[model samples]
Target: MKKIVALVTLAILIFSCSNKKQGNMLVQGQIKGLKKGTLYLQKMNDTVLVSIDSVKLLGDDTFLLSDNVKDPVMYYLTFDGNTTEKRIMFFGEEGTITINDKIEQFGFNPEVTGSKNQDIIKEFKKIDARFKNQRLDFIKQDFEARKVNDEDKIKQLEDDYKRMMRKRFLFTAQFAKNNADTEAAPYLALTELFDANVRLLDTINNSLTPKVKASDYGKRLQKFINEVKANETK
Candidate 1:
């Protein structure tokens, strides 16, 4: 009887180990103050957001999740599969990543590490925030000028706004060029240069390294450029 019980225990242990998911990327994190909840690791599949891995916490704030990452791409850490809000976005690649954040601020700002692509994005956002502020200033000035019926001020603001936009485009293009070897370069082009001039888009795309040009964002950027050029010819 004892032998049969031991055999059963061994079989259960083997079954549990086999059921555990193993992947190239490992994401482990701690959510302070989170005592009980479900955490989901998701990514965009074509256009749909799909959950690749998930963990439910009962009494601990720490969790571990992973996925088989083929290429570096943006992944979302959401609570209870909620993709609409409070989702922490990060670039995931082959390797272990660590994330730490408080439950209250959840997705507002999380310390993410272990991915070079993510570091590049963080650096870009710092400078991009300044441009965003300038844009808001221009919008406010335009609104006030319109309120006073100041046609001259409105025209001047319009010209200034156009110049600012041009400056921003150039900055983004140069930034992408500087990081041409990284996947972030193509990603920036796809997201930031969509409405930019075709020439600028082409410049960034051309600057991409062969490896980056083969990445997911790189392929998408190439396809987008092709579509734009095709439309221009029509």
Candidate 2:
């Protein structure tokens, strides 16, 4: 009778372990210089940011969170500390992901791994930064022109700024068209070029693959375009 009970307990243990390993994603992270706090794994459900998992860090700053991921989506790691709250956003995909960062600069810079989508996001940001820098330079020149009360120079700079903005918008549209197979395509259109002309938006939307157009962001892009058209008719 005792041998029979032991066999049943062993089987249950094996099954529990197997279930854990079958989860779609495993996020393991460690924060340096963190003595006590709570780490929350969060995702946006519609408009609300909901916590999916959390761990209390007493003496150790390491944590592991796992969940079943249906698609590549955005996830946030939020740290509730004694004096400050920090949050970091990343693209979460299937398989194991690792994050390492310091408590002081929690969200500013962190080493993240295990998602191809995140890598693509990083590349996009680099290109976007160049446009931002150019805009800032124009703003500085405009400021100088105003100080000198040079109306002609200011007008020329204003025209230059508008031309530069148009060029940036075209680049973003091209990027989205080229990467229509990836989630980043719709995301860029929605976030970066939502204020752009409807024709440009339509160009990107039409270029998307059927599979991509069926994704969450893809549906959002379609809805946004519809709303834009409605407003135009109004």
Best by the TM-score measure: 1
lDDT of 2: 0.85
* Residues 113-179, model 1: lDDT tens digits: 9999999999999999998999999999999999999999999999999999999999999999999
Per-residue accuracy of model 2 over 153-232 as CA lDDT, tens digit each: 99999999999999999999998898888877888899889999989999999999997798878899999999999999
Cα RMSD (Å) per model? 3.9, 6.0
Residues forming the 10-long window of minimal summed lDDT in candidate 2: 80-89
> What lDDT does the true structure give each of the candidates?
0.92, 0.85
Off by over 4 Å in 1: 1-19
Clashes of each: 0, 0
In model 1, what is the error at residue 29, expressed in angstroms? 1.1
